[model samples]
Target: MTTVRAGGRLRPPDTRGAHRDAPLPAPPVSRRRGLSSSRVAGWGFLAPVVAYLCAFYLYPLYRNVDLSVRHYTVRSFVQGGAEFTGWDNFRQVLQDPSFGTALRNTMVFTLVSIVFQYAFGLALAVFFHRGFRLAPTLRALFLIPWLLPLIVSASTWSWMLNSESGVVNYALHLVGVGRVDWLTSPSWALTSVIIANIWIGIPFNLVILHSGLQNIPAELYEAAALDGANGRQQFWRITFPLLRPVSAITLLLGLIYTLKVFDLIWITTKGGPGDSSTTLATWSYRLGFGSLLPEFGRGAAVGNLLILIALAFGLVYVRVQRRQTT
Candidate 1:
C-alpha cells in the first residue's frame, strides 16, 4: 500500500498498481524537438499562400489607398510619379454632376435587381423544392444563364434587346405596342440593364435558397399538416421563419455584387445614352481610363468609396448574422 494525497484529502494506493499509477516520463528531447519541427513544417506549408495574398491583395489595396489621395494620371502612370493632393480627388468626385446621377442609378439598379431576383428565385426554389419529375434536369438547365460568361450573356442580351430589330421589340410589335428603344434610350437604358442583371442573378438565389429549404426537416411539415394548417399558413409559419437567415445573407451578398456590376452594364449600354446607365463602377472606370485627362486619383477615390460602402454593408450583415446565431 502507498499513500496518495491531493486537494487536502488522502487515500491509499495498491502496490500492485504502482506502475499504472506512476506519472509518465517526459518525452525524449528529439521527440519534443520533432513536435516543434512539425509545427514549423506546417507553417511552411502555408507560407506560399500567405506570400501570395500579401503580394497581390494586400499590395494592391495599399496602392489603391495611396492613389486615392494623389494626383495620379496617365503621365504619372507612365513616368512613375504623382503629386500629393489632399482631399481634392474626393472633392472633384463628389462635385461632379454626373456622379450624382451615377449614385442614383447604382442605388436603383442594386435595389430593383435584388428585389426581383429574390422574388423570382425564391418562388422557383419553392416550386422545385417539391421534387416533381425532371426537376433536377430543369434546375440544371436554369443554371445555364449563370454558367454563361458575363461577356457572352451581356452580348446576347444586347442583341435580343436591340431597339429596332430585336426579338423583344418584335414580340411587342405583335401585341400592337410600338418599338421600344432598350439600350439606346436614356430613359429605358438603366431599366434594361437592371432587367438583364436580374435575369442573370436569379439562378444564384434559387440555388442558395433551395439548399436552405432542403435543410429544413420534412417532419415539421408533416406535423404541421396533421395540425390542419393550410399550405399558405404552413409556408409563412414554417418555411418563411426558417428561411430568414438564408434570405438575409443572400440579399446582402446580392446587394454588394449588384452595386459593383460593371461588365453587364458596360457591354450592354456602356453606361451610355448620356450617363443614364452609369453606375459607380462604370463611372470610376470612366474617370481613370476613359477620360481625356484620366483622373486616376478621382477614380481611386470612388473605388475606395465603393469599398467603404461594401464594408458598411458587410458589418451590418455580420451583426445581423451573429444576432441570429446567438
Candidate 2:
C-alpha cells in the first residue's frame, strides 16, 4: 500500500480511487431517447409474430368460445349462420355419453402418461447424471422417440402392435404369453394409446429432469455423503427439493401436451373401438368433422372445456412458481 506524507507525518494512502472508479452517470437525454427508439424498433420487429398469433391462435380461440355458446351446424358452417344458445351446447356435451367417456379417457391418459413418464425420466436422469462411457451418445439415442414426428411414430407403432401379425404379439407368442391385440379392441385400445404416449414422452422427461439434476450443486451431494446420507435420502431431501422448479415446468408442459394430444390417438385408434379411447381433443374432432353431419357447436364446447382445464393448470403452475420465488 502507498503512503502519503502530510505535514511531515507519514499518512495512510489516498483511498478515493474506489469512489472515482464508480459507475458513470446516466446517459444524455438524447441517448435516452435513442434507447426508447431502440425499444420501439425491437417491438416493431416482433410485430409480425404478434400479428400472426392474433390472427391464428387468438382469433381461432375467440371463435371457439363464440361457437361454444351458439348453435352451429353444417348449414351454419356453409351458409354462415349461428344462433346464440347460451349454455345449451355446454350442457348437452357435458351430459352426452361420449363426452363422459372422453373426459375419463383424458384423465386416465394424462395421469398415466405423466406418472410413467416422470418416473422413468427421473430414473434415467439420475442414472445418466454421472459421467460414464458413451453417456452422451446413449442419452442422444434415447431422444429419438421424442424427436420422431407424431404421425410417423403412430404409424410405426400401429404396425408393430397389429393384432393379427404385429411384432409385439409375435414376441408375446414366442414367449408363450399368447398374442394380445394392441389396438382395435375396446379393452386394450386406450392402453395401447397410453403406452405409445408414454414411450414418446419419456425422452422429454429425461432431458428436462437431467438438466435439472445437473443444475444442482455438487457440493450439496458431497455434504450429504459426509453426513452418511444414503442415495435415496439425498434424493428426496436434497435433489428432489432443489429440482422443484424444473420438475414443475416439466410436468406442466407434459400435462399441456398430453391434454391436447390428437395425432397419436387419431392415428392409433381414432378414438375408437366404440369411443373407448376418446379424449376431449379426439372427441371434439369427432363431433366437428368426423360425423356425417358436423355438430360444430358441440365440438367447440368440448374444445373450450379442454382450454379451461389447461388454463387451470397454467394458473396452478404460476402459483407454484410464485411460491418458489417467495
Candidate 3:
C-alpha cells in the first residue's frame, strides 16, 4: 500500500482489474411535440365537411331567419331593399282560412302515411328476413321506386289515376266498377295523394326495417327458442326492443317527408277541386308564388313554422336516442 483515504488504508491498484463509467443517456424527445400522422390525417379529412356545413347549412339558415322578418318581393329583392314587419306576417298566415285546411290535411296525411308505411314495411322486412328464394331480387325490385325521380313517379301515378283512358279506370271498367275521378273530386283528391305518397314511402321503410332485422343476432333467437319461447314471444321480447331505435328514426323521417310533400299533390291535383288536397307546403307555395301579390313574408312565416315543427321532432328524436344510448 502506498496511500490512504481520509479514514481507511489504501491497497495498491491491480493492473488486471478495470473501472468503467456508463455514458450519460441521450435526452428523450418530448411526447407532446410528436404529432401522430394518423390523427393529423383524420382532422384533415373532417375539415371539408366542417367547411361545407358552415357555408351551405348555416348561411342558409341565417338568410331564412333574416327573410322571415322583412317584407320582400321580386322587385324589392332586385332593388336590394326590404321593409321590416314584426310578426304581422305570422298574424296574416294564421288568419287565413285555407291555412287551417292545409294544416288538417297535412296532419291526416302524416298520420296515415306513418301508420301504413311502417306496418307494411315491418311485415315485408320480417318476411324477407326468412331468406326465401329470389328474396334478393325481390328486394332490389322493391327499391326501384325509391331510386326513381320524384317528378317522374308523380307524373306516372297521376296519369294512371286519371278518370278517363287510364289504366285504373280501364281495370275498374273490366270489373264493372265504373269510372272513378281520382284527382277531380275533392273527396278523393287528398286520399289519392296520400295513397301515392304511401306507395313511394314503402320502399324506404322496407329497406330500413330490413337492415334493422338483419342486425339482430341469430344467437338471441336461438336462445329464446331453446327456452321454449314461441315466435310471437321472441318478436315482442327480442325483435321489437332491438328495433326501437331504427323505428324511431324511420318514423321521424317519414313524418317530416310526408308533412313537406308538395310535388305529388301539385302534379296530380294542384291542390285543386276547391283546395281540398293542399298541404302546408303547397299552401305556402300558393301564398308565395301562386297569388297575384306574392306574400313573401307570410310564406316565410309558414316556412318558419315548418322549421320549428321539424326542430321539435328532431329534439324529441335526440332525447330518445340519448336515453337509449345511456
lDDT (Cα, 0-100) at 196 in candidate 2: 94
User: What TM-score goes with each of the models?
Assistant: 0.89, 0.87, 0.84
lDDT of 3 at 318: 84
Please write out the lDDT profile of model 1 over residues 268-320, one tens digit for every residue. 99899899999999998988888688878889999988888888998988998
lDDT of each: 0.93, 0.92, 0.86
Give one digit per residue, the lDDT tens place, for model 2 in 14-63.
77997799899989999999999999999999999999999999999998
Relative to the true structure, candidate 1 reaches a TM of 0.89
Please provide, for model 3 over 1-326, each residue's C-alpha lDDT reduced to its tens digit, 9 standing for 90 to 100. Answer: 35445457665665343434545666556653355666788899999999999999888777766767889898985676889988888888889998899889889988998889998999889888989799999999988888999999999999999998779989989899978999999899989988988889999999999999989999999999999999899989999999989999899888877778888888989888887998888887887788888877777788788778778888887887798789
TM-score, candidate 2, is 0.87
- Taking the candidates one at a time, how many backbone clashes does each contain? 0, 0, 0
Clashing pairs in 3: none
**What is the alpha-carbon lDDT of model 1 when measured against the actual structure?**
0.93
Best by TM-score: 1
Which is the better candidate, 1 or 2, if ranked by TM-score? 1
